[model samples]
Target chain A: MSLISQEVPAFDTRVPAYLQRLERAMDALLPPAGTDPDRLHQAMRYACDGGKHLRALMVYATGETLGVAPECLDPAACAVELIHAYSLVHDDLPGMDNDDLRRGRPTVHKAFDIATAILVGDALQTLAFEALANAGAIDAEQKVRMIRSLAHASGSLGMVGGQAVDMASENLTLNIGQLESLHARKTGALILVTCQLAGIAARAPEQVRHALDRYGRCIGLAFQIQDDVLDQIADTATLGKTAGKDQVQNKSTFPSLLGLEQAQHRANALFDEARDAARSISGDAEPLLWLADHIQQRDH
Target chain B: MSLISQEVPAFDTRVPAYLQRLERAMDALLPPAGTDPDRLHQAMRYACDGGKHLRALMVYATGETLGVAPECLDPAACAVELIHAYSLVHDDLPGMDNDDLRRGRPTVHKAFDIATAILVGDALQTLAFEALANAGAIDAEQKVRMIRSLAHASGSLGMVGGQAVDMASENLTLNIGQLESLHARKTGALILVTCQLAGIAARAPEQVRHALDRYGRCIGLAFQIQDDVLDQIADTATLGKTAGKDQVQNKSTFPSLLGLEQAQHRANALFDEARDAARSISGDAEPLLWLADHIQQRDH
Candidate 1:
């Protein structure tokens, strides 16, 4: 054998593979674009397409660390991405954030009518559970467990709860603790569940699962802080969405409360914590470690 | 036992019992009114609180015919009602039907802000799946099946699909067949799933399940026709919603497409079909039989 290394790079090399698998899985799960109720199906596909697929990456990463097969993770990765996509569609509605653009393109309600956007969001959410339940490779009991985890993470006490608080927080100031709690539920819950789902699918030991959970929690908060920092520093063109929306909406953010330098420092500290948690796991954790560093340093 | 009839009437006696069970079960499932996301939890409860409980009764009626205990059917009953409640919340949004009143109270969007209303609907839908997945009495395999069935009935090809078509159909004329197809998916899918859920819960034989499915489909269509008939003839006070809004919105309804008398005649024919299907089942099908007549003959 040659002295040169043959192994692929840790994280970047696998992202496109995971994203391609996720796209195929999600496309299969979604109703075809030209089917009856064509507009809704088309909008559902539109909303799900072209995302960064970060949450799905988390699912694949966690599953990979546990030695679970990628096909077993496909349904779950698709499910979380669908949930994320639906949330975005609803969040962009006129009564909510009223965002006209997303990912450098018109938002769902802008591309389609408001009624179709609402239905698209609703259908996408339903399709998430449907995908999980129909996952043939996963056992029935495990499927139930994943469904329960996802629904709990997405429901009133989870993501939607966070959105409610976030909407209420506009024009009102929130302290650091309150803000963390809000982010923990809003964006953090789904991110955390991405790890939990893979752990459940793999039937990982409780100790390993707990460590993975901790890594997920740390990474989730760090990801949000990075988003806040990017929202302040990045332009609309680079971000692919309107920048400085937090300040414009009067929504509190890490930089708004902690200052730019302090927010960056806090995110770095959390990244360290996430890396340490990843190290505590027993398997191939390099992907998770790289993911933490990558998420923390992403400009968008 | 005395010579005089000792048994309570079949359907009438069980109606109040089923409604009470539904109320208690739903109350247990919902977050308290003053929870962290207080507005959303409150609105979800408000949307679920005062419906006619017809859907829940269908679960009970079907389960009773299958010899499944009422408690065994509670989660499924609660789930269908939750789905129905979420549909109404979304359907009444400003961009959708825009109705201000439902069941004699202000619609969710009218009672709360539009953002909260949307989140309430989202959270409620999640809770429906959560309830099924967490149902203590249900086996995991059966839970997965129920989730699959519920999600299919609620997703793009089902209730939401119908809504999409209905939204697109505004100011457009449709044939009688087209109107039936729309209502069948819109109102009929969830109604059909209510029986399918109870059947799954009981593990009823396929032949019996098919009869129940047929009964549900017939009743579902008949129920929508009755709604259209009431929308034409009933006043706003009695109907507990805007009267004759279908004609005003220029959406084609059974009564609008066919004559009022013809629509009633179609509904009567469907009710007869439903009764026949219900009677073909071998058990205490009195409840299903009673439901068909009660739905047919009732006035708002």
Candidate 2:
């Protein structure tokens, strides 16, 4: 399943450009870090600042491959990133994972008081919806659809539900199917919606949208498996988070169920499927292809 | 400012009907209590139940007055109530107010674990936007506008901002203006947006919408002042929550700064203004007038 034998393209030259654009858009959407309620606002900006911007890159890459303009995708990009950031902020609270670091910095509750951390998460979630609601260049119907998809993906049956199940599953054994379902909701739902947002923004036909969704599904699971693998092999310094904590927490991970080697093989299989789905779509999918490869090969 | 001189109409017969409709609509929107992730879903329902339904009632009353169908207003009503419920859940967290009782029942964090409470709040907040986004009978444009208003009112610059300020202001002296500003955001923003949702649903003219906004603003402040006044005068049994906690927590209140009598007078003044605004709107105005009177006269 290795892609090294095939002719590979250079890294997407557009990645840095997309990252810059997303940052600018996010800054515009966020409240000024200096304003009153200064502490909460500053924390909000801080939580958002350092990240891989992976979800946002999905939005931009998917939309651009479908020939949608980059500017039109900014709000959707910001929405997913904000949702991701807020989830981390809440997850790292004392009642949850109680992690001290994220993105190589102190967690929100560690840097600020717990109350401010809760508010920051709450406010960031609100801002995600606001960004989509106010996003220009898209029609009202599409915006509504995007908002609906994003909300559903983030709600109890999706990301939050997954988190709840994950929490409840701690110290309990889960079969492979159950673990996949949980990860599908906890991380995969948001990842899947990133592509959905882009498809909605592009006004893509049903078939193209389905293809993009398939692509998203594959990469989403692949990315998560890779994460689990990294937790086993990567150091805390490289991961920018406490590594191997999953084993310590006794949580069921892909590697735990399938063994590390089988787990990585599974991720490779998903990445290959993702590449095929990307190729099935009309227009340039080189970026999607590049993203799939990058996700599979990333060490941290 | 007293309205004792005017002859009052009987209580609005539609109030109970609106409440019934809102409850049914909310039930339909929420996941079944017995579903998987049972604990989180159950806690969400638990937090939502037993509220006074004042915000949803505001939506129903105002929309009905402006001639929007009750069915059209149901989603908006559910949305505001969801937002209010989520706020209460998070506000009761140990890191925040650490309240043990709400509406005479154990707080979500007390009945459920803090992790469940946090997820419940997060899920409910997502559900609020989902309700608005999926609202039937409204055109795409109006739905977008409602979503925008709700998100803005809920985000950093609105309810969350007010909460941050309130938390920071504990044990510190705040001037009358500062206290009012804080309460306006903490409580008033959501209340004001309730009427705005109704107006948007009704597609009311700008003039009438403006009048409803005036009525909402007046009643919102009046409502908060009455709450402060009740905290000073009422006991825990009557308030269904911990009374006198504000003073105990060293939080400033209207009666604390203005003295009890003056604070009550100020609430009455706001009530009178709300009545005038309600009268100006071209509609039955009876429901709104009744709501204003009800809010002003409620003991809890």
The fraction of correct interface contacts reproduced by each prediction comes to 0.97, 0.85
lDDT of 1 at A282: 56
Cα lDDT, all candidates: 0.92, 0.92
CAPRI grade, predicted model 2: high
RMSD of each candidate relative to the true structure = 2.5, 4.4
Q: lDDT by residue for model 1 over A1-300, one digit each (tens)?
A: 595566757777888888888888887888789999898999998998786888999999889888899999999999999999999999999999999889889999999889999999999999999999999899999999999999999999999999999999999999999999999999999999999999999999999989988998999899999999999999999998999999999989999999999999999999999999998995458888878877877888
**lDDT string, candidate 2, B1-300, tens digits:** 486567644437767888899889999999999987899999999999997899998998888788788888988999999999999999999999999999999999999999999999999999999998998889899999999999988889999999999999999989999999998899999999999999998888899889988999999899999999999899998999999999999989999999999999999999999989998995458888889988887999
- TM-score quality measure for candidate 2: 0.96
List the lowest-lDDT window of 10 residues for candidate 1 chain A: A3-12
Task: Report the Cα lDDT for candidate 2.
Answer: 0.92
Which pairs in model 2 have colliding backbones?
none
**Model 1, stretches more than 4 Å misplaced?**
A1-9, B1-9
